[model samples]
Target: MSFGLVARAAGMFAVTNIDDILILALFFAQVRHRPRGVAIVVLGQYVGFAAILAAAVIGALGAGLLPESVLPYLGLLPMILGIRAGWKAWRERHDAADGDSPVGERSDVGILTVAAVTLANGGDNIGVYVPVFANSGTSAMVVYLVVFLALVAVWCAAGRFFATRPPVARALARWGHVLLPVVLIAIGMLILIEGGAFGL
Candidate 1:
């Protein structure tokens, strides 16, 4: 694989993976001060991404086995996730604020949970990844993997940077309870529309 080709592949991967920043940002906003909290989220992202990569690879190898229609239905995952998150936020808002527990004391961030959500959020990305993988040979795929893994670290750093900003952090904490799920649902809808799912 030429360096240029690998570079282009990296660019394409970044472009397709851009929307995930929002997902990561939201998750990062919920990070706790615990030693493993942020690490769990970061690791969860890789775990979830691995799942996506595996699916895309399979689709690429199988080529014709999966129907394109499956692509749009994946949107339902994020949509449902958004709906659930919205409900949770609403409930939390309605609950009495306990004086004993400071906000952010008890984190909702779970490694497996984050991984599951990431998987749902990324479900639609297979559409792009499958074709990219299919066109490339084994060597290019390896190059793509290297570029992708490195970029995932970069993405995590970016998310953490954004999350740690005092002003942005305050804003997200204040409004994210309401906004995050709406954004997630919108993402799901976009995926559906883009994939032509549900006759969109």
Candidate 2:
């Protein structure tokens, strides 16, 4: 109930999810001209973020049942995802330069698809959220949940806002492909090192 607790929760959630705004901005740019686009994008974000929260809860609870070393290997998911994203970006960049027309557009923009991408893109969040949730008291956990859920809205709005701005969206489109993979890889490495994986 303390203001400090609320402030800490707000900061943690915002910082942890900062990268998502970049991803979300691209998503918003893709769908912005469509009818009710913002609503759909926001809904997708909520569903995807909720999935992450669910995974964090499971990890926190299962942490006690699993071997201590298991946590470190969890970092592999994000690393693998990062590699895949990097490869995709490389292909897209080459295609763009070659005038080969990058990959065909998807015929559908279902919430499920968005949710899956969000979850995969956010794979690194699991490592951070698990330990934090595991250590928190029930009251603090509740505060964190409420704060994170609320901030997801703010995140979506910011992403959408950025998408409406041409220069920002274009710059992100040009650079985000490169940056996303690097950020994910960095986060994954940080998690592994902090968890003492591979004896490093």
Candidate 3:
């Protein structure tokens, strides 16, 4: 039971970071320099994430979206995602030196762009969590939802705060950008290992 809960949480975290690309792009937009616009983007992310959670819950209640048998296989997705993230990080680092900004390097994107990017990324979260929630027993559903939503809220709040600051924001924009891919890869590999993909 505790193991299932942990598995679901891992799935949610793995999928959620897919939006970092969009968020990264938004930081380069001047809109991020303005508190109001940045807040809107953050709010948009919350709305998108909340919707995914609601959708997952509905899917879970309606039908078994994630059977216990499938949990192990689902765990392998993070490892694949992580590989892509690492690649993206390397690509961005190289591009930056050449004055070629990665997609997330723009800060001038409007509400529509931010919303679109966030929603698209949110779709990945839906795919991963919905199945896990569907297989989760009633005893664990609420716990999973609460943890997932809380994490989303915290992420948005912290993101907004950092988006509004300059020095901290710049440092994140510079150094943290590279770390994002590395973290994504690490999370993916961790999930795969937990899922027993390596048979260790």
Candidate 4:
């Protein structure tokens, strides 16, 4: 409710989660044509972020639901998902070349997949949020949660806007199958390196 509290919460979320916009944009691009794609993406984001917030809250309460070391291992989730997407794309390409059928416009990016990726990508967020939440009062924590959730919607809308731009959309639509796996793997590697996972 206090302006300072709101600002602090907003700043924390923005600083910690800025990378999410690009990831959401990529997801939006991949699923743009599906009737319920946007809804699914939003839902997936919420689900993932809810998990991150839960962890932070638990850590603030000194419960330590997951050890900090384990966060780096979460990076493996995205890497595996990337490999799976790449394999699927390869199979689809092979099928197309064999005249089995034209490759469909649809994507296999599902809500759970998006949620998993988001959660995996939020390792740094957990690290930052836990301490901040612990230092704050219950009311301040409520404000932070509200601001963070509100900004999630804002982030999703902004991502959709960028992804739907004519040029960007065309590029993504044309090469998204190839690009998605690369992006996912790169993000996973970045997370691992940042967290010093597997000794980098």
Candidate 5:
């Protein structure tokens, strides 16, 4: 029974977080050269995912910490972050054109930035997890949480593996500045539309 529970948990996590692989890969591409970069990304992922699980657990326990309507507005967080990144990229381009050092040489994405993006991206995961958690017994919920947390490490490693691939690394080094902002904004817009935010 415990093994079954673990398998179920793993399946659910994989189903819900499949998109996270690409996002994590992009993050790894950005930070892989920095000191403690892998640790920072992993820590941010955990902080964000821990918040998601906390919300699910709370909802399962019948405590309404946030209203359903407010969930869609969570999409704004990513949109805002995307805009900030875009502006930074723009500035870097202009600086490079002007013969000044490129601001892109420095890392702008910190742990909180990664955490915010992760949390924003998991809005859908919360919707999926709440009912499953609410229906499960305490032991099942524990198993699910354990499996989910453990898989986060695997996800990070997979992301880093992809980011470090020769072709992928070269492409990212050339175009990641543009791609990151575009992806984040697209994700935010998708979340909003899917959530029916602004009647879209």
Candidate 6:
């Protein structure tokens, strides 16, 4: 077992946007109408992340699509994702009308909708995590999966907790579009910096 690899995976998990996972959980909470559905969504997200991590590791090692030396370029992905998220947030913030109830205004979110939104929001996090997975071997991958799932579970629980309250739920729904992107952008920038971009 490589302690360094485990540490890197944990570090990458920490700085990435765990909040969007919550937003996704909130969307699931709204759609399922049952509080337990949030758990289902959380499970799905872990499965999806595990698939992504496996792909990154296998593809990098087997096909060599991602060379170990090129891992630093993963930093650029977060920068781009950050800028894209900031742009989307700015657009939504400016486009919405006054007195518009954001979350309550659109309550008919479906499973596919939640999935698509979750995947879009996960871009930066995926980019950061992929590189880390590529650097590690089997044992590190297991550690990564465990830690990532645990953190995601915690975040989803928080989202579901707030989503159960009418007032808080409404507030989240309204500001979620505006807030989610901003948080993602901030996290993306941090990932870029930590991924060794400054030395450039």
Candidate 5 runs further than 4 Å off: 63-107, 166-200
RMSD of each: 7.7, 5.1, 5.3, 9.2, 8.9, 5.1
Instruction: Give the 10-residue window scoring lowest on summed lDDT in candidate 6.
Output: 95-104
lDDT of 1 by residue, 1-200 (tens): 68896787676556556546646766777874667777988999999888988898887778535575565565666577668768987888744233121323435778887778778867756655665565557788778778887888887887778665656544444565576567557656766787777677
How many residue pairs collide in each prediction?
0, 0, 10, 0, 0, 2
lDDT of 3: 0.57
Q: Which ten residues in a row have the lowest lDDT in candidate 5?
A: 95-104
* Tens-digit per-residue lDDT, 1-200, candidate 5: 57887987886676557556656777787887888888888998899999999998987667234566655555665576668767887877544234222222435767887788788878756755665565566888898999999999998897789766746544433465576566556656766776688998
> How accurate locally is residue 148 in candidate 2, as Cα lDDT from 0 to 100?
87
Task: Please write out the lDDT profile of model 6 over residues 80-187, one tens digit for every residue.
Answer: 665776687577664434534323344765445454555555655665555445545557767877776677666667666765565665554456555545554554
**Model 6 TM-score on a 0 to 1 scale:** 0.60
Q: How well does each candidate superpose onto the true structure, as a TM-score? A: 0.61, 0.65, 0.60, 0.62, 0.62, 0.60
In terms of lDDT, model 4 sits at: 0.71
Best by TM-score: 2
The models' CA-based lDDT, in order, is 0.68, 0.71, 0.57, 0.71, 0.71, 0.57
Supply the TM-score for candidate 4.
0.62
Shift in Å, residue 177, candidate 4 = 24
Task: Point out the higher-scoring one by TM-score: 1 or 6.
Answer: 1
Off by over 4 Å in 1: 64-106, 166-200
- What's the CA error at residue 42 for candidate 2, in Å? 1.1
Which lDDT tens digits does candidate 3 get at residues 152-199? 656666665665564665555466556555555555555455556557
